[model samples]
Target: MNNTNTVPLVAILRGVLPQDVLAHIEVLIAAGFTTVEIPLNSPDWQTSIAMAIARFGDRIQIGAGTVTSANDVAILSQMKCSFILTPNTDPAVIKAAREAGMQTCIGCHTASEAFVAIQHGANALKIFPAGELGSGYIRALKAVLPKHIPLYAVGGITPANLAEYLRAGCVGAGLGGDLYRAGQSPEQTANQARAFKQAWDACQKR
Candidate 1:
């Protein structure tokens, strides 16, 4: 939602504890990642988000993922979160978020869902479980989607295969476990983040 076309990588910290979240985020920031999401399903996720925002709001865009309800959107809006990402297309949620002046990246698997999400005011489309659908699937979807609609590939995304998704027309990606594991040291996570950044930079160069 934050003009991801310029910096397309979203670091997803699904299981990070609030106590360690800031450190993890710092590592990601050091590696040049400007967007991060903490899934609502994680333990004390809200606290983690609030802490991140309080500490680094000006430096990076913090967001919440796995959002399902309009209430969730309202909470994020109050927090001034940068964006909301869902694993499925929910018009109500998307509308609520947009009305609250928040950016949304709704999930969609098929062309129909993609169209519906766009109609509902989604800022971008997240091609979820993208590893299973593959880049070919994305290319097919792109044939019907508006050229300006940003498409982000999530789930099973790795630095090695990210280029394929980009070539297939994905504007960006949401990197999860491949970028961070709950127990990994900050240095280890930073190394992974840097590797992905390098891959994305190389892909852009081409």
Candidate 2:
């Protein structure tokens, strides 16, 4: 997996159409986002991912999210997708992805789930519903997690609250609705990406 330290915001493009995926990716890349995921529930999601990897795979990391089944792992691996982001931790899925040589970012809320994911070879951990869990949750969780493990706070994150989670010890955050909404224009995506990138930059200065 690409280092999250360079560009800590992971832009999640949910419900993005195949036709517009590349445009959004182009702007995100220009705005300094090197990592992005198109959740599988989106329309023709696999096609969008394929197009993204074909175009910008060399420039940035491209992957899918909301993955639940090991069944999909083979398909994604065939596409040479760089990573998989699951909303919940499933040891079988984690092992399958790792065996396929794809990076796995498994979501977990509590310590038990987090440890389970780690043991299954997760490349990173995503704290879902992070806004509700609060940065305090991450702070407490970080205390016990392996120092080398990366924690990403996903859900209800915005440029305004982005830094708070980072300060709480998140390596980065997964940006969803705040970054892109279905039918949003590429220009709008560019603006949103710039705002988040600026937020991350400002956080690094503190």
What TM-score would each prediction reach against the true structure? 0.97, 0.97
RMSD of each: 1.2, 1.1
Write one digit per residue (lDDT tens) for candidate 1, span 149-172: 999999999999999999999989
| Clashing residue pairs, backbone N/CA/C < 3 A, model 1 | none
TM-score of decoy 2: 0.97
Candidates' lDDT values, in order? 0.92, 0.92
Which sections of candidate 2 miss by over 4 Å? 4-6
The true-versus-predicted C-alpha distance at residue 15 of model 2, in Å, is: 0.2
